[model samples]
Structure formats: C-alpha cells, structure tokens
Target: MADDQSLITILEDSREIRDLLTETLQHEGFDTLSFARATEFERNMRGLKPDVCIIDLGLPDRDGLSVVNTVASNSGAAVLIISGRSNTQDKIVGLELGADDYITKPFEIAEVVARVKALLRRKAPKAEATLSKIVRFNGWTADLEQHLLTSDDGKVERLSFAEGQVLRVFLSKPNRLITRDQILDDLSNGESDNFDRTIDVRISRLRAKLHDDPNNPKVIKTIYGAGYIFIAQVG
Candidate 1:
C-alpha cells in the first residue's frame, strides 16, 4: 500500500483496463485519474502533475510513445508503459524514449501496484547527509531535487527519473569504475536481461544531455570488458 496519497494518472484506452487500474490504485490509497484518450490527458496533465503516469501504447488520439517522451522530457513524473506488445524492441524503444518501467499486458494487478511503489521509492528524496540537492561537475549544474540539468551556457534540460538516477550514481563516484551490476543494484532495478540494456540506454541519454559525444566520450568512458568510469571532477 502507498504510504502517502500519491497522484497517478492512467491513459489506457481499454475501458475495462482503465477502470480496473483506477479502482485498484485508488483502493491501494493512491489518487488516480483515468483517461481513454491521449488528448484529454494532455489537456489536464499540466494541471494534475501526476507523480506517476500509466500509459498504454495503443491510444485513440496519439501515439503513446510520443506521450511518454513528452512527459519524460517536460515533467518530473515517472512513466510506466503498459502495453500488449511484449516484444523486446518495444520495451527497448519505450525505455529509450524515457519511460522508467515497462509492463506487458496480461500483467497481474499486484505487480502493477508493486511497480508503482518502486517508482515512488526512486522518486522520493533521500537524506541531505547522503546527497546534496544541487551538484556541479564539468561546468554543469544538476538540481537533483528538481531533476533539472543546467549547462554552463545557461541552458536548462529536464531529466527523466531514470536519467537522474544514473547521473546520481556517476556523480557520487567520480573517477571511479562503476559496474552495470552496481548501478542496477543501487537503482534497485530488477535483475533481468532487459535491465542490462536499460543501463546502456540511460547512459546514452545522459551523455546526450551532457553533450558528451558517444564516439569519443570524455565524461563517461566505457571500458571494453569492465564497466564505465566518470572522469569529470565533481563538486
């Protein structure tokens, strides 16, 4: 059960699925708003500012992946993609586009509840002693509390929850080699083959935000067989 009354928005087109999710989440102590179309959700998104968004791929108004990308880039909310497409490519595409988690259709409601809780845990703020609200490195500033990244040129970029989590790991251990396993462990992301690929996609996304060229990356260098190392001086 959710500890607090976190707001959740469901964008599933199926009436049964939407109602089921809304009722289950509400019963679990979460405030939920269900929408059958993407346009309706988008119109109220800015106002609602849900903590988590449960989106389905097949929507009547717009592509769900596009919606996920917009939400991930614009809002601090975590995205969970629920679709009937169980293929690996779909999952990868969803994560690459900034979704935090992907759940295939025919999923257990309990699993949905658990995944929601996990996302909330990741979004929750940690103790001040462990992490500063703002961190700077290589002339870039990261507001961890706000999940905002500001460049030396005064440009600001919003980071998805997954990207922010990866950045936190690297910033916390600069000039040190951090294995993928360690990252997954710190993130508490499930141990699965898909999650391994998830780390790579997240790092790729973070590098883009940092303006780090993937061909010859300077900030985050990938060791052939080992892992990755953050070489920048963080403060």
Candidate 2:
C-alpha cells in the first residue's frame, strides 16, 4: 500500500488503460487522476503536484516525450513512460529524455505497481548518516534537497530525479572507480539486462549537464571495460 499522501497522475489516451490504472492504483491506496489528453494533464499537474506521472507516448493532443521532458525539467515528480513502442531505441530515448522508468504496452498492472513503489522508495527521504544538503564540486554547487545545480558562472539548472540520484552517487565517492552495478545497487533500482546501456545513457545526460565533453571527458572518465571514475576533487 502506498502512503495516503502519495498521488499518481495517469496520462493515457486509451480509456481502458486509463481507467484500469486508476482503479488499480486507487485500490492500492494511492490517489490518482487520469487524463486522456496531454493538455489537461499538463495544466492540472502544475497544481496537483503528484509524486509520480505515468505517461503514454501516443497522445491525441501532443507528443508524450515532449510532456516527459517538460515534467522532468519543471517538476520533482518521477516520470514513468508507458508506451506501445517496445523497441530498445524507444526505451533508451525515453530514459535519455528524463524518464525514470519505462514500460511497454500489454504490461501487467502488478509490474506497474511494483515500478511505482520502487520509484517512491527512491524518492523517499533517507534516514541514514547525516550529510550536507549542499555540495560543491568542480565549480558547481548542488542543492540536493531542491535538485538544483548552480554553475560558477551563475547559471542554474534543474536536475530530474533520476539525474539527481546519479549525481549523488558520483559525488559520494569522488576520484574513485564506481561500477555500473554499484550504481544500480546504490540507487536500489531493480536488476535489468539493459543495466549497462541504461547507466551509460544516464551518465551521458549528466555529463552534458555538467558541461563535460563526451569525446574527451575530464570529470567522469570511463574505464574501457570495468567502470567509471570521478576525477574531480569534490569539496
């Protein structure tokens, strides 16, 4: 059962899917709002402040990926892409564009619930050792609580929940080699066969945000076959 305060917004055009998800999630103790069009979803989301947004790629009003990007950039909600496009490329693209997770058509409702639970777990505040909420590294300041990054030049960038998690992993162990498996373990993201590719795409996006050149990266150096090392001296 989800927390009473946890709200889930479902944006799917299919009435069957939309209603099914709403019924199932609501039955599981989650508050849900279903939308058939991207326009209404976008408008209501600004005020609802849901904890998770389940989006379908095929929408009548606008591209679902565009909605994913917008939500990721502007909100702290976890973005889950539920689409009929099952190709590897589509999943990769969705993750690259800021989705926290992906599910294809004909997916089991149980899996959806599990995925949502996992995302919520990751979003939940940790009660472990105390750490600073603000971290400075490589001429950048990260406000972990707000998921905002400020560059030395005064430009501020908002980080998606997924990006913020990846960044936290790197910052926690600077100048140390961190394997992809270690990253997944630290993130508490369930095991998947596409783990490598998923981590690579996330790292690539984080690098771009940090202004690190992919061709010749300085901060995060990829080890040919082992893992990656954060070279910057983090403070």
Candidate 3:
C-alpha cells in the first residue's frame, strides 16, 4: 500500500515472536515495523497507519483483544490475531471482535505468512471497496462494496491489488482485445523502463483468482504476444 510493498505493523512483546514475524514478513516482500507494547504501538500505528497489523493477544500491559479492537476501531489496518491461545473459543471471540485472521500458538511461519497475504488481498480497494460497485463475469461475482467475491457456490476468496487492477481493466473494456503494450503502458503509467513481467505475472494471478484454466481459458484469452481478450458476458 505504501509504494510497492504493503506496510505491516507487528505488535508483540516477545522477542522470539517478534523476530519470527519480522523474518516471515520481510521474506514475503513487506515493509514492517515492530513495537514492544500497546503504548508504543498506539503511537506508531496511529501515525503510520499500516495496511495490516499482526498483533499478539498476550501483551504485557494490555489485553490483546483490546489492542485488536483499538487498532480496528481507530485505524485503517486490518487486525490479525496471532496468539498462544489455541482454543476454538479464543479464535471465535477474536473473529467476533474484528480480527481478520486468528492463528494459534506453535503455528508455522509459512501459515502466518499465508494468512497475512490473504488479509492483504482482502484489503485491496479496487476489488473489495470501491468504484464500479460490482463486476459480473461468467459465473463469478465480485462485489466492491462488500469486499467479497463468490464463484457460484464456492467460498468467497479475496483479490489482491494486482488481480483487482487486471480485472478492473478487463471489466472496463469487455469483449475487446487489449493490447499487451497498452496494458503495460497503463499498468506502468508509461514510466517503466524497457519492459517488465509484472503485468504478465499479475494476469496469471488474476486468471487463477477467476479459476480460469490457462490451458483452456474461458474468461481471459491470451493473444499470443499481442494482448488479451475478455470473453465473458460482462455486465
């Protein structure tokens, strides 16, 4: 959200937990900031306003749930409950209290990273929060207002920033062949030097979100070094 990497605030008093989280997050290409306690976090998080907050439920001086509530209640960051609590009740309560994701103790770093990525995906404004309101393609549904996506009866999956951008472009120009060069120019705002694979990677990722088989694509058809065509019945 800030520049290219999303800003993440990790609030945990334990040095081990803090180190593990920072390692996992930095490996996933995130810009991270850490705090020792609620007081320290309150000042930094409010001022920085990261897109995501990975918070431990066992702070030294404050209730972790209260921190989650405060962050969610006051700031824009999506709060994730990362704690030693393993009971189902703890998880349920965390979710009820506005936690986007809750992980138990002894969790794998990869799992934490995955959950963070998913939360980040759900935070994308283009796919989840504004403009156009909705995009209807084939049997898939994208609701910007609610930040939800439903593929027929399947569970709702969140869209990342790049996926949202690629889909938004197609939704804006339905049934039309969009030139690769045009897409590159638009995605990079013509400021990219030479060429980059970012657009291609994003398109692939978008197709995955739509559940479109790259081998026998239904929604987006690649034009073989040219561009792409959105063949769905858009509305």
Better of 1 and 2 by lDDT: 1
Stretches of candidate 2 exceeding 4 Å from the true structure: 191-195
Clashes in model 3: which pairs? none
In the range 1-235, model 1's lDDT, one tens digit per residue, is: 6865689999999999999999999999999999999999999997877889999999988999999999988888889999999998999998888888899999999999988988888777655536687999999999986789998999998898778888898988889899877888777646234456678888998999999999999999999788899998778
Please rank every candidate by lDDT, starting with the best: 1, 2, 3
Ranking by TM-score: 1, 2, 3
Q: Whose lDDT is higher: candidate 1's or candidate 3's?
A: 1
* Greater-TM-score candidate between 1 and 3: 1
Number of backbone collisions per candidate, in order? Answer: 0, 0, 0
| TM-scores for every candidate against the unseen true structure | 0.92, 0.88, 0.54
lDDT at position 138, candidate 3:
86
Per-residue lDDT over 35-79 for candidate 2, one digit per residue giving the tens place of the 0 to 100 score: 999999988886877889999999998999999999987787888
For candidate 1, list the clashing residue pairs, or say none.
none
Over the stretch 10-84, how does candidate 3's per-residue lDDT look in tens digits? 999999889888877887788899987998988766468587889899899899998886665455466777889
For all candidates in order, the CA lDDT equals 0.87, 0.86, 0.71
